[model samples]
Target chain A: MNTVWKENALQVIQDIFRNQFFDDSLAITEHTTPADIEEWDSLAHVNLLASIENAFNIRFTADDMANIDSIAVLLATMVERGAC
Target chain B: MAEPTHMLMMAKEHCKAGEHARALEVLRSLASRHDPLPMQAQYARLALTIAQGLEGLPVLRVAFLAGSTLDHLVGALRFWLLLEGFRLEPYLAPFDTWRQEAADPSSGLYSFRPDLVWFFLTARDLKLEALWGDQPQQWQEAAAGRAAEVATLARQVLATLPATVLVNNAEASATRVLGNFEGSVSWSAASLQRRYNLELAQALPAGASVFDLEHLASCFGLERWEDHRLWCHSKHPFSLEAHAPVAFAGAKLIAAAKGKARKCLVLDLDNTLWGGVVGDDGVDGIRVGPDAGAAGEAYAAFQAFAKSLSLRGIALAVCSKNDPDLAREPFRSRQGMALTLDDFAVFRANWDNKADNLRQIARELNLGLEALVFVDDNPAERALVRAELPQVAVPELSADPADYMRVLAEGAWFETLTFVEEDRSRSRAYRDNAARNACLAQSSDLDGYLRSLEMRACWGDADQARLSRLAQLVNKTNQFHLTTTRYSEPELTALSLADDAWVGWFSLSDRFGDHGVIAAVVLRFRGQAALVDTWTMSCRVFSRGMEDFIFLKIWEVAKGRGCTRLEGAFRPTPKNGVVATLYDRLGGSSVQQDCGQESRWHFDLVAPPPDLTHYIADANGSGN
Candidate 1:
């Protein structure tokens, strides 16, 4: 269940970031963080989370919103919550 | 305060001359902190006039409260509304304030009192979290619970606020938990969104409308619609590219809401109405109906749609550049043709320029050119009409023959907020007027013609049944209206019951047919004088001595009330100048040559009314 959810969540996140950066070659992985992307600021982070919530038809709680700082943490949260 | 009327026209001229910056400066000088005009239509037209060639229009007071960041969407909506002759001053509520603004009358939404209030909330704002890890049954329950909250808010707004509330349906994100198989499950996002929309629609009261944002996003494609970058930065769900289409839908709805809907459709023939030009292809050779290929079928479908418009009360007319007989032969002879000669109120198939022809049609129908929507398949003809007669709405048609019907129908120019029984019979009335014109043309002596046609003016008090029609006349009649003061139906009803006021409408019918209520008069008794508050007559009855008949009726009513004098005024508008000499012709002694914008006249009721004895016989049913 974790593997399928993680894979789907990772794909949705990567699609959003790629469009954001306007670079089809931009890549994402478990370790990717805001420091890895120059355009990833606090404003961009909220927009990213909102887009993911809409695309995946799920929501992030206050705890999940604060704790998810990287791609791996975000996907893990979705997988553990069964939201992907 | 609003700018003077002359200044507004000067700014419009500057815009027409392509001095957009100058026009903007002119408009800015007239800007007020409050709503500029007392009348909604006047404000809309003024905004449209000043906004020409400008990047953004004068923002009307519109409170936009939605779940998503809608800066770009509002920009697009504002521009689109301006194009459709509206400029909304958008008051964007803070995020998550939709409920608070709607439920509380003391909120900024009510304080601002926007002409239009738009609410756009996404699934996340409602039940996204509740649906997570939920089964089909659980999903249904969550959707129902959330939708009820939205409905309750809508009801509260409808009760508390006087603005038109526009609520957008929720759009499901492209990410599907169940993928393609989600359709089979009730727990799916699509299912939740659909149910939410249905419930929301049922909850909306009158004065509230639904905007299908989901369908609009689909038209723009879901992939392009959801911009994660913009959404992350600003919470804007829609991309910049999607703004035009989104704005267009909202603008069209607003135009209809304000009763600025186009009234008449002036069509062209040959390549426009059929697959081929009738003059060149001959009557038998022209393609129409389903049997003729795809193009012919499209033309036939178009005719059927035009026929439907006629039935719905939209006046149909023809202004084609063709021989008269050839222009009308297709409608008369073609078995597949959906429309007939009688469908059109005016048929002008001559070598005259289309602009002149359109003017003639407007005159014959007693309609303003601003009320006309000209449709032609020919680009050159369309361009000519657009340039020469700028007031007439000339929509550009697609070059493809098969696209003609869809292009014109999708415009939805003939929009209406309310439908009346009289709308269905509007074309028949115009047809009757055409018959009257035919009789007038054949007669040599004008009096003999009027006498031969058995005419009767039925005078009666305007009751509740005729209030809507009377108000429409008051609002729309321009050419023959003296003191053109538009009134609402409720206002007219109040006047009818007022002790000092009297309101009456007259229906004119001749040997040809009934012209419906062709004249209306409003009088206010002050001391020994009856002030003619309003005297509006349909231009169709011009030169038919209907004015004389109405003058006589007004005299009788004034005398009955023991008033010694009947006072009248003629206020000049661009179209109403035709009635400038009306009071003079009625034999009223000039009281004031200029009372600001209007000229005043009065008649002594003790002295007899101008030689209307000839009309007395007709009023008593002797002429017939």
Candidate 2:
């Protein structure tokens, strides 16, 4: 169960980042942050968050909108919302 | 369960990857389909890629003066316009700089000279915040002050430019502090904001039109209307997906202003109008009403919707590949039927290709093929027509009869800003043409046939009462328009009052019925030449010698005004090819050809040719 959940969550996050940024080869680890990618600006960050929220059927608060800049924060929000 | 929306995006994606052939196929699919674009078009970067590949599309300069961030919305706007065969050249004013751009004449807004200026000021933009227990007068004061500012800005835009201005009504407040009682509270944010929208719409300048975002929010559902989290991050009023409808509404408004609105809704018989085939299952066996159960009721409801559309002046037509009597029997003898034979302007039921039938229908109704919106239940028939005559809009109708009315209404093919008595009387004029056609078959020769109809015409100076029809003629008449110039009703009124110009309207009546205001003319009295700036006639009277009757009066009025020469230009369009040699046939000499695209023609008024002959007698008796 743990292995299946991790794979599915990883696939969903990867697909959202790939489609949203239109970069097919893009890969993300939990530690990845805005400083690691040049395309993840403030506007693109909102787009990425919106895509993950839609994919997970969840909502984010205003604090999360401004503070969630790394893949670690996104996974934490997704798990807190019972997405995993 | 593949939605048609997903398939349409293939065109842009394929074109992005340089797959030309696949892109062409999907673009063809997008063209043949009906309804609006989907939300996936919000990717601004992708839309630019698709737009860059398209060649020779008409360009509309649009300026967005908004209080919110517009970086993401511009892509969806350009995507919708591109789907409608127009490329959007938009100038985005800096965030919250609308007041500065609209007031300063030398600002970038004026220098861009946009054809459409979109003002998007949301409720938040106006600071209509909900109060816990503030004074009731506070809400009213804020609403009224913002309303007055919008009205003043609208006047300034109209005074500075002649372009069409689209002002979005503020979205009602999402915070319903009083819940169900919010509407009843005078000082509540929802109540005050609603009143502010009404005041702004009513007080706008004559040329500006409201976009009605409040009504759009209700339809789109206020729950998902705006994202608060994204608003805090980007200052965008709504999420990217919600901008789809806004973009579509803007494109349709621009299209209607340019006279690209579809005029006719052509339907098929058989399973289309009833639950069963009319020919296979006879009129009595067909199911089409409340008594015929569920499927029949759906067809009946669709029929009622068509009747309402005809009342609003959208010409209805029937095109079927069956025997004429069998196809029309349901309307003839059936009970509980919403549509009757009289509702349709033209009925073509024969064993011919649907595309050819549509061509004949357009010819009989005196309309361009682009003016038709064809609806059929058969996919093969829709595909054939789409491939052959691409100008005709063939909707991707489902097999379910219940979805017919919804699909057609969502197409919004007949979008118009104004409706007049003239529009309501359009079907009557087209129906009269049928009787005239039957008379033509009985007469022997052209002259003898026209004489038998007993046609009488009335010509006079176009006044306010005739402004609607005159504007329709000058703006929408594609064929036989000498100059093809467009003018709003207000502009036309101003031109009529000028001393050096003459604007006249002509109406014709025959034994069948009256065809009201069939032609309009605008002539500028130059020193030695009376130039014809505009000459547009209804296509319904195309071959009835109406042009001959109209041109005789043209030079006669110019000669009476003491002009030595009568001059005009033939500016060509795709649909105006029928009138390429109009001035030449009118005994006028071609003086100059501008790059072989537009030509100038002249007629010597001092020694004008003999007046053209027509059978119609003058009823007003003022134009000698």
Candidate 3:
């Protein structure tokens, strides 16, 4: 566990989310809605999901991601997955 | 706010460059920024908290419980807290109780409808932890029983919560926990991970994959203290550092790992073997003494290492830029050199571009370029080799003589996972290949040369026995690959098990030598077309037209299966340009084109080309 791990994970997730959602300002937060982040396409979603999984060492089922539409949901999912 | 944003960008840049301390400074700067708008201020505060969290600083999360308007901030804080590995028990308790009371239809606060109360509680707990260190052991003990009670209640409330809300809570919590455990662990980190894994598993519906702290730990090699040093200073728990070891260990672990070169080192002599030119020094004049004054010590160490690799099943070969007679003399002379001519399987010491020499060496040794690691001290020589033959791994050696052996030994790129029985005889096999090549070069007719050796091909579905060799070819054979698709064992398993797909591999041998599994073809049946997903041949058998024979075999299989045409895609890559015209040369017509289009070749099975006679059909349909 180093200082960089969390930051790196956060940055990578952010970059992926931003790139996929086409919105750089979208903060990865509990309340951030997927609808607000335009880059949340199906492919981007899967890529972000996989990237986050790889980054944090957590896995998400399709159903788990299906309902996760906001930054809050993502954060909660990370918690539920024991990655947080 | 803009300052914070700029600081954040700078910090991110520094982190990418492997400067963690510098990144922390920027984050600290951002944390000091002030904003007028509550939302902006709260965003900055959350960022500061996350930065602190990354640094392993436990600060209690600040809460805005004044009104419903603060709900968003509360939720955001909760998300950050969970990512930082803080427990959410204290935060969820009040929300669960309120939900239970509100459901009775008799509560006055029912109209209050705390949409973000749970999120607020989560944020407050984090703020508490941040401002005050870890919660007191007594507080934790007292809260543990109550926490469980709250969790039970929360579950009941959670059932009625919007899916988005539930998912958001879950995601935020998981991220915080994962972030904390990813690179930093004390007693709290491990316990948090364990507890969270169970909690998340329980909270998540069935079939949801949980990315737990343990999984993150292993994926990033976080369990090992030494490995943690790679990413301990970064913001994210996972990065290139986490994956580096796995990449290093990838050559070894087969079940979850992928492509690796075989355990045979085809070495170059002359400048490669010793510091001074070997031809100029002669056997006796060459420096091999332990004296600090002598340059030959490095050569001696290099030989010792090479011998060690040989003992470990790595076959050694000599491809030098020197007189064959002069090079052979030092190895055999009584002056007691560490390496002898017999130490190498194939010794090709001639005045030829090393690339061509390497090609000859591969052919003579019956090995693929992918399996060979060419080490030469000269930059020009290394570059020439790299440009002409990209498949062969030509690692650049240091000009400093002292680092020669150390570089070879420590570099994980050449590491091997498993040593098989045939590895010991690799040198001898190459020696036979050299003899075979010599015989073929002397013969005018190709068929006569192939027949003289009495070649045989063995075809079969790859099994555990041949997995290593198959992987080696896949990793190293770059020139003739159709798609050049690389696969780990798991990926290969998926491909093989996928509907309408099959992997066919072939190994060739002759009285000359056994050319271990050197060809792999991935065939996919898609509707009317039998797509050759991946097709590659070892460079050793290039001019012999083994590809033609292989193509003919594939055609026969496709024709029998009632396929109209066999389609092959030639995706151009940096290395495979040598065979860019393969489809046109192989009698395949182009059907379509797109921007950055990989050349698509379609061969109607009704009129397959006449089989070339250069190779005699062996038991496995491979040409001799």
Candidate 4:
């Protein structure tokens, strides 16, 4: 994988997490839960899915956006979708 | 802990957490709290009213405000009512008796509170007619009289209050609303500033700036509100991301009210402005008669609506893919045609691709492509224009001509500020541009073209006569622009007066005709670096290299002032791809590369590009 793509992927992950969580200092981990950040409410979960899709220039199915709950699950979904 | 304050905090938390339904539930519970203190009751009522309004629950909003609560609730109700499309008169009716009682000073209402009296009187006066029924003429007259009396009382209260007191009152009472700022920062900022100016003039006292809730909202990517908890929690009431219709409507209103309304409505004729293709239908076969038939009536109605837009001062132009003579015959000969050839400012009826035809129309009208809203019923045509001329607002229209009028009316296309004098003169200005083009086409050499047409370029500050044109160009010009910067009218005014900014516009005319203010250049001086923030030339003079001439003049001014570097930026937009290579061709080196950094271009005055003979030198030895 290209180093730039790896960096961009991490940055995209960070942006999605920060915006969804409203914690600028948020460090995206594989185990982060929706409840851990006060700002990661139901609406932010959907927004995070959409942002990730846009950053990766891919489409997320309704099921995909709805099913993902944790950062680990989201990352797995992205990997399954070949987004990273 | 007080139940109402506790509920308020919970609701605030839910609202911040993007759980609008949960927030609304908490607010409802707070409002239903039994027999609370007067202050608590008032706060609860206000909170419920705002929350219900945000939730799009008009019934709940009305119930909370109409209750026998404190008088401040009346003011909150009035604002919410306005937001929900109810006129001011209906919302202020219940406050009349309180105002009269307060006037006596010893009355029970006066003993309760002096501020409440003012609020009651102001609300009543502001909305008198709606309180009193419209049926009885005598009652209506009485309501009007009371309204005037209440207005006087409100003025007295305002006059009695200190400046600081009024400011504090305004700050506390100001409603927090959301809007879309989707375009350039200059355009958005100028529009907000204009609204700030107007709000200050109408509601706020002098020196008060309308706080930009939109800009504040944008700090959290509020433009994409599913990302902003403030918006997602408000039930998508204020964010462009969640509610594009509402956000676009808010932005359009702000833009229109500031007299920054777009200049031209570039329309596609066949199946768009009219029912059938003129080439096939011939003038008579076109569905444009006042007959009772559905299709015929629809076409006639659409034409009438298009014509009515002219009365509102929106210039209509045509770009049709048909023979010019055949396409134009309907306007002149059709029995029920409402929009005539004279109604259009520019008409490009040729078998050329619509995108090209639209480009010609923009050039002939001396208006910016961004100022145009192209309406074509054909999806393919709309898509082609969308791909080719992305700057043009080509709204999708139904193929069934019957739906055209309603679509135009309901869609925020024709919404604008007050129609000014220049609007009526727009059609004639395009006619002049056509003549100028014809003269230019006749000449072979550049100098011969300039001399034969007797073209004179007037450059200076925009006066009252030309300010509107200058504003339109600033807001709309995209292609051939050094930087496609959009500005509202008030921002243009500010730029004209700013010491560091040199704003100049040119009106070019030859013996054939007058091209009304077809070019504008805005230069900002920051210490030693001079920046060409906005440099746009009308598309009509694109091949003429009028921009090179303008840049030469700008360079002279910059050189004379001892400026070190002449910096200009070409922001690569989907529509401005034509200008992507402009800086490179003009001898400016790129200093950065990124999504947004594609716009930055810099030129040092120490090195000048090779001179070209394209520009004709005016008698003063300066290229005009």
> Best by lDDT, which number?
2
What local distance difference test score does each model get? 0.74, 0.80, 0.54, 0.55
Please give the interface root mean square deviation for model 3, in Å. Answer: 14.7
Name model 4 segments beyond 4 Å from true.
A1-84, B1-248, B251-298, B308-325, B342-403, B414-424, B430-451, B462-472, B484-495, B526-529, B559-569, B577-624
Residue B616 lDDT (model 4): 35
Candidate 2 residues lying further than 4 Å off, grouped into runs, are A1-45, A68-84, B1-13, B16-44, B126-149, B185-188, B197-201, B594-596
The lDDT-based order of candidates, best leading, equals 2, 1, 4, 3
Report the lDDT of model 4 for residue B310: 68
Per-residue CA lDDT of model 4 for B168-266, tens digit only, reads: 111111121223431232223223333332333355322121223333234334334332233223222232232223223433443343323466777
Q: Worst ten-residue run, lDDT, model 3 chain B?
A: B162-171
User: Which of the predicted structures, 2 or 4, would earn the higher lDDT when compared with the native?
Assistant: 2
In candidate 4, position B48 carries an lDDT of 45
Candidate 1: tens digits of C-alpha lDDT, residues B1-624:
354655655655676677866765555444221222121122233344456456644355778888777755565555456656566677888787898888888888888877667887766677554255576677766767777777677667655655566778787677777777666656667777777778777766544667777777776688877766555545666654465566667777777665557778999988788878888989988999887888888888888888999999888999999999988998888867888998999999999999999999998887889889998988888888877987888776888767777677666678654455567777888888888878878989788888887877788778877877776677567778888786655567778999999999888878777777877789999989999999888766778888877888888889999999999988887778878998898899997876447888989999977875343234545322
DockQ class, candidate 3 = incorrect
- Candidate 2 is graded, for docking, as acceptable
Output the number of the TM-score-best candidate. Answer: 2
Residue pairs with backbone overlap in model 4: B453-B511
* Candidate 3 positional error at B351, Å: 6.6
lDDT of 3 at B229: 21
Candidate 2 residue A52 Cα shift, in angstroms, is 2.8
